[model samples]
Target: MAPTNLELVTLGHRIRHERVARGWTLDELGAQVGVAGSQLSLIENGKREPKLSLVQAIAHATGLEVTDLLAAEPPNRRAALEIELERAQASPVFRSLGIPPVKVTKGMPDETIESILGLHRELDRREREAIATPEEARRANTELRLRMRERDNYLPEIEKLAEKQLAAAGHVSGALTHRTVSIMAERLGFELLYVNDLPRSARSVTDLENGRIYLPPASIPGGHGLRSMALQAMAHRLLGHQRPTSYADFLQQRLEINYFAACCLIPETNGVAFLQQAKKDRNLAVEDFRDAFGVTHEAAAMRMTNLMTQHLGIRLHFLRVDGSGAISRVYENDDLPLPMDVTGAVDGQIACRKWSARAAFSEQNRTTEHYQYTDTPAGTFWCATQTGTTADGEFSISVGVPFDDARWFRGRETTKRAVSSCPDEACCRRAPSELTSRWEGKAWPSARVHMQMFTPLPRGNFPGVDDSEVYAFLERHA
Candidate 1:
C-alpha cells in the first residue's frame, strides 16, 4: 500500500523540525522551494501533501537527498498507520462515501488516500463523542473471545520453546523450590536477594550490571510467587526480550514470558502426566496440584487449562474474579457461551452473581474451594473456585469444564447449580416472578433492588502498572 496519511504527517513533522532547527520562517522555506508561503505552511503541517517537485526542492534546500527525507518509516509506526488505515476502510461510513476502497499502495495517489483518511478522522471523532453503553462493551468482549476461540487458546510455539528451555535446564519431575530458583539464578551469574523494604510496585528487579536480582519479602516464598517472578526475569534474560515498541508486541511478549514461567514451574511432560493420572483417578483438584507443585492456585489453574485443552484433549475454561464480583481474568477453550462486551471477555465487567466465580465470594468458609454446576445457553459446566486474599485485595480463581468432563474432577457431585442466560435481561439480573410476588412492595421503603456495578481498572499486561517506569528500569539495567 502507498504510505498512509500518518506517514505523511510524520514526514511533515520531520520537515518542520528541520526547518525550525535551521531558524527559517515558512516564507523563507517557501522562497527556497519556489512555493507560496501559505501552501508551504499547509505542507509542513500535513494539511496538504507536497508535489514530488516540491519535495525535491525542499530536500535540496535542506541539503538532504529526497531518499533521506523520505526514509522508510519505523516498523512500529508503519504498523500503527496500517491498522488505522484498515479500520478506516472497514468503516461503514467510509464505504457509504462511495469512494472505491483502494489499498494505500504506490499505485494510489497520496492525495486521494489522504482525503479518504481525512473523512475517516471525521467519523472517528463522531464515534469518540458517542457515549458507549454496557451492551456495546459486552459486544466488544464477545468479539475478542471469538478470536481466542479461533486459536483454541493454544500456543504451540510457546509450548515448544518452554519444552526446549525445560530440557536445557536439565529440569526433572519435581516441585520447584526456592533453593532451586536461587540456584538457577546463580548459574546465570545472578545473586538472588530478598529485601523487606522493596517497594510494592517493584515485584522484582534484576540489576544487570551488578548481576543481582532484588525481590520483596512476600515474593520470597520458596514456591509460586518467587519462582514465577524469578522465571519471568530469567525469560527477560534468556529469551532476549527487548523493549517492545508497540502495545501489541508488549502484550505478546508478556504472554510468552508468563507461559515460559509456568512451564518452568510445571514442566510440560510432567504436568501432562500428573493431569492424566488425576483424570483417571477422577480426583483432579487445583489446590492439591498447587500444593504438590508448590505453585499458587492461579498458576496451577492456568497450567491445568493448558493441559486439558492443549494436551489432555479435554476442553476447559477458567475465570477469576475479585471480591466485588468484577471479572479479573477469564478464558475458555470450550463451547460454553461467556458474557462478552465489544472488546471480548473483559476484565472488570461484573459477572452474573449466580456464576460460581461470583458466588465463591459469598462462601462462609473461604478456606476451601467452592464448586458449582451452571446451566448456560452454551451448555452445563462444572466449575471449582477458590477465593484468596492477596496484597491488593480478595480475589477468586475458578476452572471449569463441560458437564461431560465433570467426572474427571473430585467436586463433581456438588448439588450447587444455577441456570444462567446472561447478557439477557430476563436472566439472573431479574428476580423470579414467585420471589418478586412475595417481596414486592411489602418490606422495603423503596421496593426496588438496584445492583451497583463498578467498572474496574482495565486488565492486561500490568493492568495498573506504570509501563514507562518498567521500561526505564530495564533500560537502566541494560
Candidate 2:
C-alpha cells in the first residue's frame, strides 16, 4: 500500500525538526544519510517519501531510534503548524478554491499560516453544516443503534405484544395476511382508510380522535410496505405512545413501532419454526424468508437481525445501500467495522465499494440474490445481497454473517469472493497514486453533491411529518 499524504507530511516535518534541533543544514544531513542536499530538501518539504534504509540512516545520524522519528505527533508547535498547513493545502476544498497554497518557509510568520488555516477551518465548517439536520437526531440514532446491538436486536415485550395481537386476529400459521392486519386495526378501535393525498412526508397517519389510520392508495393485495406501515401506525396506539418529548423519544418510538410491525409481519412463533427447519436442512436464505412472509428482501434481512442471534445462535449484519453506494441503513452484531462519521452515525457515510452490497449491483442477473465471501480487515464475512428498485432509486439489501456461521445458511459455497482493506485511503475512496500524480492539477470536475447531504429531517410531531399537510389532506378527504 502507498503511504498516505498526511503520513508523508508528518514524516517530513519530524525529520526536518530533528535536523534543525541538531543544528545541521540539509547538505550536512545528506552527507550522513548518503542522500543529495536537494533530495533532503524535498523530504523536509513533504514532497518526497524517503526509503526505509535512508530513514534508518537519518535516525542513526540524529542519535534516535527509527520509531522516535516516525511518531505520529510532531516535535513542536512549529512542526504541528507545518503539518496542519500541509494537510489543509492538500484538501479537496482548498484545491477547489483555485488558490495556490502558501509555502511555509522559515522567513514566513506563524500568524500568516494561522490565518490561512482559520479560513480553511471556517470553509470546512460551513460545508459540513450545510445540512440543517440536528446533532441531537444523529446522537439519537447512534444511541439507538448501540442499544439494539447490545440486545442482539431482540425486543421481547414488542414480540410478545405482536404475538398476542396476531393470536387475537386468528393468525396461526403462514404469512400475516392483509385481512389479519385490517382485523388488528379494527380490534384497536381504528379503521383503515386509503387516501390519494396522505401528506408528502408521512408514510401513514394515525388520527387518535377519529380512530382512523390513513394510508396511501398505491398498495396492492398482500403488499410489502403498505401492511408494515399500517401495523406500525397501529403499534403507536396499542403501545400507548404519547407525543415524543425529544428527538431521542421520537427515535425510540419510531424504532419500537417498526419492531412491533416486524414482529407482526413475521410472528416469532412461525418465523422461528421456519428458520429452525431451514437451519436443520442447511438451507437458510433471506429470499426464502421474504417469500414465506410476503415481505421485501430488505425487510426480511432486517428482521433476521432481531431473531438470528437470540434464537438461532447466529450473529449477523444487515445493510441497505443505494446505487451510489451510500448506506441508508445498517445493523451489525458481528463487528463488521462499518464506516461512521465523528458523531458515530452511519447515515452520512458510504459503504466500501468492495462490499458485497456494492458488488451485487454489478451482477448481470438482478432477478436472484447475489452471494460473496468478503475478506475485510475485521474478518471473513459471507454475505447475500438482493437488488431492487423503488421510487427513490435502485438499492441492494444484504444480510451477512461471520465465516463460522456460514454452515447454517445457503450460498456458503459461492465461488465469488473478495478482499477489502477498507478504512484505508487506498482501499477504494482515494484514487491510485499513479492516477493522482498524472491528473492532480489537470482535472477540474464539478462534484455532484448527494441529495441526502442537504435533506434534513422533516419537522412535526414525528420526524419527516408535516402537520398542516396532514390536516389539510384529512380536511379535504373527510
Q: Please, what are the lDDT tens digits per residue for candidate 2 over residues 114-192?
A: 9988998988765543322578778888999999999999999999999999999999987778788999999989998
Task: Give the residue spans of candidate 1 off by over 4 A.
Answer: 1-148, 197-200, 220-222, 432-478
- Any idea what lDDT model 2 has? 0.87
lDDT of each: 0.74, 0.87
Candidate 1 lDDT for residue 77: 41
Q: Write the per-residue lDDT of candidate 1 for residues 1-478, one digit (tens) a residue.
A: 5666666765676677668769999999998989878988787555687788988999999998888767645224433354466668767767777887656553665566667678789776655433234554455445555665677666666677766766655667688667767777787889887666444456887788889887766642554787788888877787788765334445556667787888878877888888889988999899888887788889899888767777777888888888777777878887667665555546667788878988888899989989999998888999999998878688989999999999999899999999988878678678789988999888757553324456542332443345566567656545
Q: Looking at candidate 2, what is the lDDT of residue 160?
A: 99
Stretch of 10 with least lDDT, candidate 2: 124-133
